[model samples]
Target: MSNTPSQSQLHNLAQDIKQWGAELGFDSIGICGVDLRAHEPLLQSWLDAGFHGQMEYMARHGLMRARPGELLPGTLRVISARINYMPEDARCATTLEDPTLGYISRYALGRDYHKVVRKKLKLLAERLQQALPELKLNYRPFVDSAPILERPLAEQAGLGWIGKHTLLLNQQQGSLFFIGELLIDLPLPMDAPANPECGKCTACIKACPTGAIVAPYQLDARRCISYLTIEHAGPIPPELRSAIGNRIYGCDDCQLICPWNRYAPVTQESDFSPRQQLLQPELLELFSWSESEFLKVTEGSPIRRIGFERWQRNLAVALGNAPYQPRIIEALEQRQAVSSELVKEHVDWALEQQKLKKDQEQVENRQKARLIRWIKKALPFHA
Candidate 1:
């Protein structure tokens, strides 16, 4: 347990890590040095511009997010790993088009990815430790659980490039995968960074519902639906509510529209499979759940962190955007009376939306009736 490994030993270890990652359900693994100082300026600019919104942890960490060595001392090489989380039959477009159905982000439809990806990364790290028992190996695993800038690290490690949507995109796997990191002290051969493949394609930028992607590689999280519904705890902005559509939780519009996603592999992991209850459930049915029911159903899932109040708040906005269904109106009304100021505000807004739709439908029906009467007078009954 006292000898240092040769350069050849380090190279072999990197290859073994990738193989171990695959056996642990990770789709891809790459290694890179932790000199993210080049990204510090951009990170500071993003924080200064308030693009992170209420996610103050982003700023609180400062440039340390880009410095892995600071997070875990003696870090030499970062082993970045990605696992496909896109389930079979995600029905991304179908669910989005159906206003009656609630659109939870594809990633959140199953068990929480934090635990799943981190568990596998830990195994990969353990395998490395076991491989070199005498080398005094030091390591730590992170799956979107720490302040480290994961996407940039993944891109630098050659796992993928940062797409226009600011998510990691691989030529083979696209962007429907979870990224994790294993910071290690061993000096491993680093992988070449992936070249940008996005070309002139602005599909992701155009596809963002809230225009959260203000520019290529720049995201204004304040306007993002995923941020509004999940990260932000206050009232949903009235201006952006209608744009949120039926997305009760996080969103996937950008990923759904990406051309490269045609090659996205369906996850083999059963843990990522969509639950029947959350896989495009009726807005009314989801809206009907009480606090206890919400907790029970979303237990062990990523959606549980948002709690029932935000759940109702999001559903209220979605139900408002739904077609003028009397039941939807009744549901919003029922919630509005007993809800807190936060939930009640959204419910009231939803009721107003329903009322407007009902009025518009009435106006259209009257116009149709008038047109029918005019046709009857102009031309005698032909039947």
Candidate 2:
């Protein structure tokens, strides 16, 4: 085997990598050794619990996910990078509270992050190869596409600690960021793990509308709004529909409730800002989009991957939760006329809610009139 680089040289290379990462738009960068043995058992238990839902790929990768060297042979160190994604001008709390407007997760509001982050990681890898040609570099860049445990690797690299929500949270940056990794053959200096800062904080757990976070650090993807809207293909479950409120896409209630997010920095990247009227679009407006229009508007967006059917499915559930109105009723009828059996079922349910509201209003009006008559009779002088 060839001789290893000196300790000073390795340390210098590590410092150079951090600087290069910053220049390439990464908010932070750190190195981690490829030994995730301690994490393997927890991963297996999560899979065994069937918490991954329909995402069989999570279990398909098996132990390779925890073993970076096995996944990409000759990998000695994993370079983890984070990029803040909360756009400076993006809508947050106000958009979520509007029952008539659709609420999309902040990260997916702009261009698809997977493509952007992967491209940057690949460019960073190329720069490293050119800088150290004598070093036999074997690197593979990945974003969310692979089965890599990105959060654990990022935490191990001292990027941040895993918060109660199971998301990586930084002391200075909070949890509003995207993570990417570059597995390489170079043996670089590793950073020490950051101290956990989420002390006795149960805000994320209590805030989840779907109760997806069963406990601290444990998530049931089947009940997660993000998973239901983006991953699951069929009709959403009935019990969670009302709780879903007017969110036509992914949900962000947990993140919004986290106190640490007060310090979350807004992203300067314009590509991450909300696009195509997604920031505060009315539920009926999005529900009225034809399949062609959906494709056109979501061209480069991550939302396009769900296809029009699942998109309609999620919209149907949101419409069911919206306040009763004639326009909403009419929109549902129009959709029901040409909608699939699955969508028609949800439309039927929404119509029932409208009928109930109308009946309740009539009963309330009659009761108020009777109470006025009783008051007039009691006051003989006024009568």
Candidate 3:
């Protein structure tokens, strides 16, 4: 328990941390030294391209994200942990196929992962401190809350490899999981990084509805549906609205298409399960919720962070993409009457979409009727 522990002690502690992590419901855990200099240039390049879009925080931290030791003085190792978040019976394909239904990302269907993963990491850190009673442990837990480059740290820690879609993918568990870190001063023995296994696979790239995946292992966040729906604040771009489809929240298309996800296991944690209402919600039903109702339904969920205005804005786009229905037109008209400028803009767009479909249907109906009349007159013997 000395501040300057022996190599044997550090090695033993690393094993104990993994065991404790498993007991704490983590799917996997690994440790790595704070030498991410290899990744600093890549991070700088990503920011330079403005691929991060309006996420100024990503650029604000600069290279500090790749330097964990600098962010937290004396940080020697990063304890990266993974937790599976795929809910059982998510019915992703069914929901996505039904344009009338709102397809929220499976991760947000349950309680906010930031709260769940951070709490577990804090407990794990406490256990580490308790085990090393004499060693005053300086540590901090992060779950998508900081400027730290978590995926790179996770990969370096041997948890998984960064897949073509830019998410960490375990050969066995895929990418439907959350990664959290405990930056500590403990000199834990590090694990070897996982080998990349995404060879000859362009499934994720081809499957992206918005062409966000510009190349293998590269992403243009400006065109990513997840960024538009969750991160970006302004209007959903006019060009991408039709492609947005019915996904009202973060998208899972790339993950869903990855072959590795076939091995992704369903989560056992009840906290990760989808709420009954959100499991297969209709777009019209979601669009009809008042701001208070929206707040009440999404309370304690990750969806709450986007607030009601963007929530409605997203729904309006989905509704516009849905098939022509009088009820949908009525809902858009009603919402347009009292919504804010942002929501109103999307609502008006939805109205135009509905009107176009309505006109086309009417034209087709008239053509069909004329054809029927002509057939009846031409075949009088049958008549």
Best by lDDT: 3
lDDT of 3 by residue, 1-383 (tens): 25677999888888999999999999999998888899889899999999999999999999999888877898989999999999989999999999999999999999999999999999999998899888788999999998788999999999899999999999999999999999998778889999999999999999999999999989999999999999999998999999999999989999999999999999987899999889899999898898899999999999999999999999999999999999999999988779999999999999999999999999999999998888889997775
lDDT by residue (67-100, candidate 2, tens digit) is 8887788889999999989987767777877788
Each prediction's TM-score against the native?
0.98, 0.95, 0.97
277 Cα displacement, candidate 1 (Å): 0.2
Worst 10 residues of 3 by lDDT: 1-10
Q: TM-score of the candidate numbered 3?
A: 0.97
**Which model is ahead, 1 or 2, in terms of lDDT?**
1
Order the candidates by TM-score, highest first — what do you get?
1, 3, 2
Task: Enumerate residue pairs that collide in model 3.
Answer: none
lDDT of 1 by residue, 44-64 (tens): 999999999999899898999
2 or 3, greater by TM-score: 3
Best by TM-score: 1
Evaluate model 1: give its lDDT: 0.92
